[model samples]
Structures are given as C-alpha cells and as structure tokens.
Target: MIHLTLIIVDFLTGLLAAGAWALASAGGAIAALVGSGFVGFSLFRKWRRRQ
Candidate 1:
C-alpha cells in the first residue's frame, strides 16, 4: 500500500512539473512575440518620419 501511494505521489509531482514547464514556455513565446511587434512598430515609425 505504501509503495502504491509513493508511486502515485511521484506521478502527480511529475505531472505538475510538466504543466509548469509548458506554461512557462508558452509565456516566453508570447513575450517574445509582443516584444518583436513593439520593435517593429518603433522601426516603422522611425522610417515613416524620415520619409
């Protein structure tokens, strides 16, 4: 019984870690996309001003 409990706990811990990792990865990708968009807009404004 103890062995089964330990296995269940280990599996739950692993699932939580994987979920956290996936969320972090998605957040990072979103941040990168937003940053790129901001930079692109800034560059476009500067180019427009010059013309």
Candidate 2:
C-alpha cells in the first residue's frame, strides 16, 4: 500500500513538472514573438521616415 502511494506521488510530481515546463515554453515563445514584432515595427517606422 505504501509503495502504491509512493508511485502515485511520483506520478503527480512528474505531471506537475511537465506542466510547468510547457507553460514556460509557451511563455517564452509568446515573448519572442512580441519582441520580434516590436523590432519589426520600429524598423519599418525608421525606414518609412528615411523615405
């Protein structure tokens, strides 16, 4: 019974770790996209001004 309980605890820990990793990954991706978009917009404005 103790072994089964330990197994369940380990599984829950692993699941939580995986969920945290996925959230971090998704957040990083969103940040990168936003950063790139801002950079692109700034560059476009500069180019337009020069023209």
Candidate 3:
C-alpha cells in the first residue's frame, strides 16, 4: 500500500513539473513575440520619419 501511494505521488509530481515547463515555454514564446513586435514597430516609425 505504501508503494502504491509513492507511485501515485511520483506520477502527480511529474505531471505537475511537465505542466509548469509547458507554461514557462508558452510564456517565453509570448514574450519574445511581443518584444519583436515592439522592435518592428519602432523601426517602422523611424523609417517613416526619415521618409
């Protein structure tokens, strides 16, 4: 019975770890996208100003 409990706990820990990793990855991707968008917009504005 103890062994079964340990197994279940391990499985749940692993699942939670995986979920956290996925969330971090998604957050990072979104951050990168927003950063790039801001950079692009700034560059576009500078280019238009020169013209």
Q: Cα RMSD for candidate 3?
A: 0.4
Candidate 3 residue-wise lDDT at 31:
100
User: By descending TM-score, how would the candidates be arranged?
Assistant: 3, 2, 1
- Per-residue alpha-carbon lDDT of candidate 3 for residues 12-51, written as tens digits (9 for 90 to 100): 9999999999999999999999999999999999999999
lDDT of 2 by residue, 1-51 (tens): 999999999999999999999999999999999999999999999999999
lDDT per residue, candidate 1, 28-49, as tens digits? 9999999999999999999999
**TM match of model 3 to true structure:** 0.97
When summed lDDT is taken over every stretch of 10 residues in candidate 3, the lowest stretch is 1-10
Q: How does residue 17 of candidate 1 score in lDDT?
A: 100
Q: In model 1, state the lDDT of residue 26.
A: 100
lDDT of each: 1.00, 1.00, 1.00
Instruction: Provide TM-scores for the models.
Output: 0.96, 0.96, 0.97
